[model samples]
Target chain A: MTRKIPQIICALFGMTLFLLYFSQHPTARNLNLTILNDYFQIIFAFTLLVGVVSFVKVNLKAFERGEDRSYHLVSVIGVFIMPLLAIIWGIKGDSPFMWVFENIQVPMQATVFALLAFFVASASFRGFRARSVQATILLAAALIMLLSRSTIGDMIADQIPQIADWIRNYPSMAARRAILIGIGLGSLTTSLRVMVGIERTWLGGDK
Target chain B: MDAGTVIAGILTLAILTFLYRDNPVYKLAESLLIGVSIGYFLVINWSNTIMDLMFVPLFTQGKLMLIIPLILGLLMFGRFNRKTTVLSRIPIAVLIGSGAGVAIPAMLDARTLQQMSATVTPILAPDGLPNISELVVMAGVITTLIYFYFSREHRGWWGKSATMGTYFLMIFFGTTFAYTVMSRMSTFIGRMEFLLSDFLKLTQ
Candidate 1:
C-alpha cells in the first residue's frame, strides 16, 4: 500500500491536469491556476528546505570527521547567518540580507562563472585540433565566431561578421530545431510513461 | 570604497585565487558562496512562498483549503524517517505527475509543431529566383532530422546524409562554445574593471 498510494495519486493528478488542459471552462482554469501557482510554490518551498537540511547535515558530518574543518565551519555559519540577518531586518533593498546578496554573493558568483573563460580558452587551445573533416569544420566555425567577436576579425576581413551570422542563422539554427523536436518528442513520451505508471523511478525505487 | 564594496572586493580576490591553485582562501570563499547562496534562497523562498502563499492565506485570509498542501509539504520531512519515507513520495508524486501532465501538450505545441511549421517556408523568392538560403536551411533541417533517426541502419545515402548532419551539429557546437567563451570573457573583463577602478582605484 505504501508505493501503491503514491502511484495512485500520481496517475490521478497526472490525468486530471492533462485533461484540464483541453478544457476552457472557468472552473477548470481556476483549478489549474490554484494547483500550479499556490500549491506548487508551497510544496516546492518545503522541498528546498529539505535540500538545505541535507546540505548542512552532510557538511556537518564532514566537519565532525575533521575534513576541511574551517571551510565547513565557514559554510555552516554562512548558511545560518543570512537567514538570521533576514529575520532581524526585513528583506528590503537597504537591508543587510540584500546587501550581502548584491555585494558578496553576486560578485563571487559572477567571478566563478567568469573564471571558466580562462580554463575554457586553455582547454580549447589544447584540444581543438582539426584532425578530420568534421573537426576542421568545427574548428573553422569556432575560429570564425571567436574572431568575429574581437577587433582582429575586422582587421582581417570586412565579411567575417556576415559569414559568422550566416553560419549561426541557418546551419546552426537547423541543428537547434532538430534537437528541439527530438527533445519535445522525448518529453512527450516520458511524460506519458510517467502518467501511465511505467516510469516509477521517481518513487525512489526501481519497483 | 564603501564597506560592502571593500568586503566584496576581498571576497572576489579570495575566489580569484583559485586560478593559482586551490588554497585556504579560495576554499573558504567557495564554501561561503555555496552556503550563503543556499541560505539566501532559503530566506527568499520562505518569505516569497511559505509566508505569502501558505501562512498568510491559511491564517489571515482563512483559506482552509490550503491545509491540504500545508499538510502535504510537512509530509516531505517524513523522508528523514525510515518508516514514514513512503509518505514523502505522495507530495513528490504530485509534483512530478503535474509537471509531466503540463509538459505533454506544451512541448507538442511550442517545441515540435511550431518548429516544424517554421521550417516550411517559401521555396522561391518574389523575383522567381531559387532562394539559396531557404534551400540550404531545408537541406540542413532534413539531414539533421535524419541523423537522429537511429531505428534504421545508416548505409548508402543515409550514411552520407548523417555525415552532413554531423558537420552541421559540429558547427552548432563550435559556435556555441565560442559564444559561451565570449560571454564569460566579457564577465571576466567586468570583474577586472571592478578590481582596477572600483577596488584598487588604479587608473588604466
Candidate 2:
C-alpha cells in the first residue's frame, strides 16, 4: 500500500491534469483553476514548512556542537523576528516589518546582486582566451557586445550597435530557439515516463 | 538624512567590504541577510498560502473540500519521522505529477511549436533579394540543432555542419555573458548612486 498508493496518486493526478488541458468544458477549466489555486499552493507551502522545520532542527543540533553558533543564532532569530514583527505591527506600509524589508532586506539584496559584476568581469578576464578559431569567435562576439554597451564601440565604428543587434536577433536567437526545442521534447518524454510509472525515482528510488 | 538611509548605507558598505576581502563585518551582514530572507519568506508563505487559502476557506467558509490539500500538506511533515518518511512521497508525487502533466502540452505549444513556427520564416523578403538575415537565422537554427543531436556520430558532412553550429552557440554564449555582466554593472552603478546621492550626500 505504501509504495503503490503514491504511484497510483501520481498517475491519476497526472492523467487528470493532462486531460483538463484538452477539455473545453467549464467544469474542466474550473477544476484546473482550483487545483492550481489551492491544491498545488497548499502542498507547496507545507513543503516549505517541512523545510523550515528541518532547517531549525539541523541548526539547533549544530549549535549543541558549538559550530558556527553565532551565525546559526542570527539565522534562527531572523526566522522568528519577521513573524513576530508581522504579528505585532502587521504587514502595513508604516509598520516596522515593511521598514525592515525596505531598508535592510532590499538594500542588502541589491548590493549582493550588484557585487556579481566585479566577479563576472574578473572571470571573463581569465577565461575569455582567444587560443583557437572557436575561442576567437566567442571573444570577438563578447568584445562587440561589451564595447557596444560603452563608448568604445561607437569610437571604433559607427555601426557597432547595429551589428550587435543583428547578432542578437539572428545567430544568438536561433541557438536559443534550438535549445528551447530540445527542452520541450525532453520535458514531454519525461512527463510521459512519469505518467506510465517508468520514472519511479521520485518514489524514493523504487525501494 | 533619515535613520533608514543611514542604516541602509552602513549595511551596504559592510557588504561591499567583501570586495576588499572576507572580513568579520561582511560575515555578520551575510548571516543576517540569510536569516532575515528565510524568515521573511516563511512569513509570506504562512500568510498567503496557509492562513488565507487553507485556513480561511476551511474554517470560515466551511469548504470541506479544502481538507484534501490540508491533509496532503500535513503529509509533508511525515518526512520528519523515519517510520512515516514514505508518506511524504504522496504529496511530492502529486505535486510533481500534476506539474509535469501540465507542462507536457504547454512545453510543446510554447517552446517547440511556436519557436519552430518563428524559425520557418520566408527566406525571401518583399525586396526579393534573398533576405540575408533570415537565411542566416535559418542556417544557424539547422546547424545548432545538428550540433545538439547526439544519437548520430558527427562525421563527413555532419561534422562540418556541427562545427558550423558551434560558432552560433559561441555567439549565443558570448552575448548571454555580456548581457549578464551589463545587468550586474547596472545594478552596481545604481547602488553607488544611492550611496553617494541619497545617503552620503556627497554628490548633488
Candidate 3:
C-alpha cells in the first residue's frame, strides 16, 4: 500500500503540475511555482543532513577497517563540528562559518582556478597547431582575441578593439544563435517525449 | 603583510606548487577540496534556499501543516538503506512531475514559436540594404535544415546548398570553441591574480 499509494500520488501530481504549467489559468501557475519553490527549499535543508551523515558513515567504516591514513578523521571531525557550531550559534559577520567559508572555500576555489591558467597555456599550445585551413582560422581568431584584450597588443596597434568588436558582434553572435536554435529544437523534442511518458529515464531505471 | 594574507599566501603557494609536480602538497589540497565542497554545498543550500523559502514562508503563514513537504523531502534519505530505497520514489516522482510541469509551456514558447518566428523574420526590410544578413541567415537555416532531412537525396541545387551550409556550420562551431577558450582563460587569469595579489601580496 505504501509503495502503490506514493506512485499513484506521484503520477497524479506530475499530471496536474504538467497541466498547470501549460494552462492559461493564473491560479494554477501561482500554485505550481509556489509548490516548486517550497520543494527546492526542502531539498536544500535535507542535503546538509545527508552530507554529514554520509561523511560520518564513511569515516567510521574507515576507522573500523584500521585504514592507515585514518588521520583523515581530523577532517571528518572538523567538518561536523564547524557546521554544527555555525548552525547552532548562527554565523554572523566574522563568525566561524563565515570565516571558514571566506578563508577556506574561496581561497581553495581560487587556487584551483589558478591552476587552470597553466591548462589554458598548455591546451592552446597543443590544440591550436595550424594543421589545416580550419585550424589556421581558429588560431587566428584566438590570437586576435588574446591580443585585443591585452595592453601589449594595443601598444603595438590601436585597431585591436575594432577587430575584436567585429569578430564578437557578427561572427560570434551568428554562431551562438545557430547553436542556441539547435539546442532549442533538441530540448523541445525531449520535453515532448517526457510529457508522453516515452522518456521514462527520469522516472528512474527501466522497469 | 598581515597575518591573514601570509596564511592565504602559504595556501596559494601550496596549491600552485601542483603545476611543477604532483606531490603530497597537491594531494592534500586536492583531498581537502572534496570535503570542503561537500560542506559548502550543504551550508549554502540551507542558508540560501531552506531558511528563506521553506522555513520563513511556513512560519509567517502559520501553516504548521507545511511539514508534509518536509517529511516528503526526508523520504529521499531512504536511498541510504538498500532495503527501503523504494520509499525514495515518492519524493523523486513529485520532483519529476513538478519539473516537467514547470518546463513544458516555457519550453514550447522559448524554443519553438519564438525561435521559428526569429528565423522567419522579414528578409528584405524596406529601408535596410536588402537585409543581406537576414538573407544569409535564412539561407543558412533553410539549407542546414535540409542537410538534416533524411527522407531524400540532396542533389543538384540542394547538394550545393548543403555544401555551403556545411561551411556555415563549421565557421559557427569554430567561433564557439574560440569564445569558450577565451572565457576559460579569463577565469584562469582571475585566479592567478588572487594567488599573486590578494593571497601572496607579492604583486599590487
Candidate 4:
C-alpha cells in the first residue's frame, strides 16, 4: 500500500506539472511554479535538520567509541555554538557567528578548492602526453587557451586570442551542446517514466 | 585592525594551510562549512516556506484552499515518530502525484523536441565551404550515439566511427578538468589575499 500510493501520486503530480509548464494559461503556470517553490523550501528546511542530526550522531558516536574524540568534540561544539550564537544574537558584522563563518568556513572551503590546482597540474602533465592525434590536439588547445588568457600571449603573438576564441566558440561549444542535447533527451525520458509511474526509485524504490 | 578584516584574514590563512597538508585547522574549516551550509539552508527555508508561502497568501489574500496542502506538508514530520510514521505516506503520495503531474510535458517540450530541432540544421550552405563546424558536430553526435547502441557489435565503419568519437570525448573531459583546476586555484588565491590583507594587516 505504501509503495503503490506514492508511485501513483508521483505519476499524477509529475504529469500535472509537466502539462502546466507547457500550457498557455498564466494561472496554471503560476500555480505550478508557486507550489513547487513552496515544496522546495520545505524540503530545504527539513534537510537542514537532517544534516545537524547526522553531524551530532557521527561525532557523538566517535566520542563514545574513544576514536579521535578530541576533534569530534571540537566539531560538535563548533556546530552547536556557532548556530546558537547566530540565532540568538543575530549575524551582524561584529558577531562571533559571522566572524567564524567568514574566517573559518570560507577559508576551509578555499583550501579544498586550492588542492585542485596541484591535482590539475599533475593531471595535465600526465594527460597532455601526445601519444595520439587527439591527445596532441588537446594539448595544443590547452596551451593556446592558457597563453591567450594571459598578457604574455599577446607579447608573443597577436592572433593567440583569436585562435583561443575560435577553439572555444566553435569546437568546444559544439561538443558541449551535443552532449547537453543527449543528456537532455535522457533526462526527459527518465522524467516521463517517473511521471507515468514506470520509474519510482526517487520515492525510495520501485513498488 | 578591524574585527571583520581580522576574521577574513584568519579564514584566508586557514584556507592556505591546506596547501601544506591536511591538519586540524583544515578539518575545523571543513566541519564549519558543513555546519553553516546546513544552517543557512534552514534559515532560508523558514523564511521562504513558513512565512511567504503558507502564512502570507492564506492570511492576506484569503486563499484558504492552500490549507489542505499545508496540512499535508506538516504531516511529513510524522516520520520522526514511529507510531505515526506510517501516516507520512499520505503526504509522500501527494508529493509524488504532484511531482509527476508537473514533469512530463516540460521534459518533452524543452528537452527532446527542442534538442531534435537544434540538430536539424543546414549542413551545407550556398557558399561552398561545406559548414565544416556543423558537419563535425553532426558527425560527433551521430557517432557517439551509435557507440552507445549495445544490441550490435561496433565493427568496420561503426567501430572506426566510435573510436573517433571517443577522442572528442577525451578532449572534452580534459578541458573541463583544466577549467575546474583554474577555478580552484583562484579560490585558493582569494583566501590567501584575505589572510594577508585582513588578518595580519601586513600589506597596509
Best model number under DockQ:
1
Task: Judging by TM-score, tell me the better candidate of 3 and 4.
Answer: 4
**Fnat measured on candidate 4:** 0.43
Looking at model 2, the pairs that clash are none
> Which residues of candidate 1, in runs, are more than 4 Å off?
none
The sequence of per-residue lDDT tens digits that candidate 3 reaches over residues B1-204 is 665566556666778788899887766665565566666666667776776666876889776756777887788788798777777777766766566655666666786567567777677779865776666666766666566555778788887766665655555655565566667667767767866788666799
Q: How accurate locally is residue B112 in candidate 2, as Cα lDDT from 0 to 100?
A: 92
Lowest summed lDDT window (length 10), candidate 2 chain A: A198-207
Candidates arranged by TM-score, highest first: 1, 2, 4, 3
What are the candidates' interface root-mean-square deviations? Answer: 1.1, 1.2, 3.2, 3.0
lDDT for position A74 in model 3:
46
lDDT of 1 by residue, A98-161 (tens): 9999998999999999999999999888768889998888899999999998999999999999
Ranking of predictions according to DockQ? 1, 2, 4, 3
Model 3 residue B104 CA deviation (Å) reads 2.4
Looking at model 3 chain B, report the run of 10 residues with the lowest lDDT sum.
B167-176
User: Per-residue lDDT tens digits of candidate 1, residues B51-133?
Assistant: 99999989999999999899989999998878888889999999998888888998999999999898889989999999888
Residue by residue across B49-72, what tens digits does model 2's lDDT show? 999999998999999999999999
The worst-scoring run of ten residues by lDDT in candidate 2 chain B lies at: B31-40
DockQ for the candidates, in order: 0.82, 0.80, 0.42, 0.44
RMSD of 2: 1.5
Off by over 4 Å in 3: A1-11, A24-26, A44-52, A59-78, A152-160, A203-207, B125-128, B140-204
For model 1 chain A, the run of ten residues with the poorest summed lDDT: A198-207
In every candidate, what fraction of the native interface contacts is reproduced? Answer: 0.82, 0.83, 0.34, 0.43
- Which docking category, incorrect, acceptable, medium or high, applies to candidate 3? acceptable
Q: Is candidate 2 or candidate 4 better by DockQ?
A: 2
